[model samples]
Target: MRVKKQKRNRRTVKFFSACFGFREPFKVICDGTFIHHLLAHRLLPADDALAKLLGARVTLFSSRCITAELKSLGQSHSESLEASLQLIPASCDHEKRVNAAACIESIIAEGNGKHFFVATQDIELRRRLREVPSVPVIYGLKNSLLIEQPSTAQREFVKCSEEKRLHASVSEIQILRKEVNETDQGRDSFDPDQSSRTRTLKRSLDSTEKSKFKRKRAKGPNPLSCKKKKSKEVSIPSPNKEGSVPAKKRKRTRKKKDSGLEQGSGS
Candidate 1:
């Protein structure tokens, strides 16, 4: 149960931190009733308990009006008065002391620009604080401290602020329209003389470029396309046999019939 409560408190703190720009070492303004409750409940060393509840280091604050209210409670709240006195004094600037609730309300005003966390046991004060945007309220439940969830007014304020950021304002729209008109006027105001001068300059540049390069002239057909000339073959004569002496012919001799023919005659 304690873990759940702590988680809920942390989530609330994160919501304020992200949307409302609550920074580290938070400033908490404690009223008389809250101080008395802390002492009565033995929630001593107020800073440490509140710091743990806030999930960040905290600087406890008490206005002069709150201290005076605690002091008027006689000896029963002397200890609470001392505790309130020990806290850092928030600027009330009140020449005459007012009720603690009234003083705190004046400090917060409509928007909590200083980003103060109000710790009070007064139900009316807590209800009133809910109407103001970006003001986080802290109150004690039994021995535990809890931070209030953002009220509907605060949520609506956040939504409205976000929408304002997403869209442009009338002044910004007017400025943009003026800029577009100026650009359009600049484009519409064309000078004929300037255009004629530019055209002449361009013509001159073209003529100069044309003169720098020579146009290609007609040429003969490619040598590769024409037929190649055939080389002449000169006839080389061999030695004449009629002018030279002829070689002599060799005569062959035949062998005579032997004893085979004589033996045939005798048979």
Candidate 2:
């Protein structure tokens, strides 16, 4: 089924200034492309969530890529992103580094001595904002806001904290599938997590075994492991085995549906 398009109207700094910062009525520049993106796809800075975070007088711009992504997200989503975009198209063609620097400079210039803030999830923008030796600005997302000079250390700390929290939440959410000893309140607290679990090297393994072992509990892609995906072994029924079906085909019925239940009866 085709989804219906939803449209949102243009917003300004006057609307959300007080929503994110310590004070109200601040001059803020939002990344419309970012908004388009958050709304068009998945990730943080959720569309409706971010909208409620901004004010009416807000100015918005987007990276050429983000703008393209939004406009191409199709008419409905594009309209949603355009509501707060201020529709200022940013130049990202050629000289990527230069254009990015100029974009931030232009935003700062526009602020012109009043309290101005730049809101984005872009790392490079965050870096440039931190490196510049001038006015104070704030960085934010939905519901939470912070002001800083875009220091890597600060960013790293924030990133680590978020990841740690997500890991804990994920573990707590799945805790019931494994442990029976955990109390309901203990489960609710979300203390120790699988992410927090680290292993000590008890003994050195032989190279052949280490290289051949296919099961790994680590998260994400990692190099240096001398391992290749092993082709699935075909399990055959033993001649002496009784009552076991062949490893391949077993029960057969048509009109298969999902894990919930079969809608139609079968012979």
Candidate 3:
């Protein structure tokens, strides 16, 4: 009976252990924003509470972008009061930073002698940290901490890209197949030049339908040409009519009475 009771107790302990994460608190990879926000919001007491729970001073890494962005507002040293932090410079380039982060996590592991938690605003970094078999990543979400395994897919960021492509070419091909299957005869009468020719044909057909025939009157010869012909005929004058004699005007009339009287008296 004691042996059975001992086995049950062991099972119960294992169940509770699996359900609870960071029950006594552990390590962290701290994000600057998370820490600074705690400071700005006057959550310094909470920071002390967390640090006490973890049994160590919080660690900070230098992300140049994060620092430059925050430095614009003159808040580079904003988290000084939260906990004693160590700044390790970080890279924005993913592969470069992942290796760097892995190195840091490994070093911290040696000092702490176990998997210390990683805190960051970068999901990609979190995933990379998770892949390390020794260094499990612990993330700060809102007010709590979540520990999870790394993602297999690495991440990249693109800004305002027109060439963003996916491996989803198969879906496009599937859509084409569905349309083509619906009408196999669509290819038979397919006219590639149809759009270009349509406007030209429409214009020509409209002109032909609207055209009307008109029989025009022939134009007469110009008046100046007729006047010129008359002037030429006048220049070539005919025989003069005044010089010619009529037959009746040609014969002479004698003094017949006077001659008759003298002949009669002489006789």
TM-score for each candidate, following the candidate numbering: 0.71, 0.29, 0.29
Candidate 2: regions farther than 4 A off: 1-24, 37-80, 85-101, 109-115, 135-137, 140-143, 149-267
lDDT of 2 by residue, 1-267 (tens): 111111111122322232223234334545543454455454344433434444223434455544444465686765655654444554445343333335545646533344455656566776756644333344444434434433454356446766886666666768765566566556667656532542222223455567788686768766676588799999666753676664655777687578445544442
On residues 102-162, what C-alpha lDDT tens digit does candidate 3 reach at each position? Answer: 4445455432343345555566776555444344454455554334432332111111121
What's the lDDT for all of these models?
Answer: 0.91, 0.47, 0.48
Instruction: Give the best candidate by lDDT.
Output: 1
Model 1, residue pairs in steric clash: none
lDDT of 3: 0.48
User: Model 2's lDDT to the true fold?
Assistant: 0.47
Global Cα RMSD, each model? 13.7, 32.6, 27.5
Better of 1 and 3 by lDDT: 1
By summed lDDT, which 10 consecutive residues of candidate 3 come out lowest? 153-162
lDDT of candidate 1 over 1-267, digit per residue (tens): 989988999999998999999999999999998998898888878999999999899999999999998888899989889898899999987999999999998888857788999999999989988988889999998898889999999899899999999999999999999999998887678787867898999999999999889788899999999999999999655545776544555888888879999899999
TM-score of 3: 0.29
TM-score of 2: 0.29
Error of 1 at 203 (Å): 24
Least accurate 10 contiguous residues by lDDT in model 1: 238-247
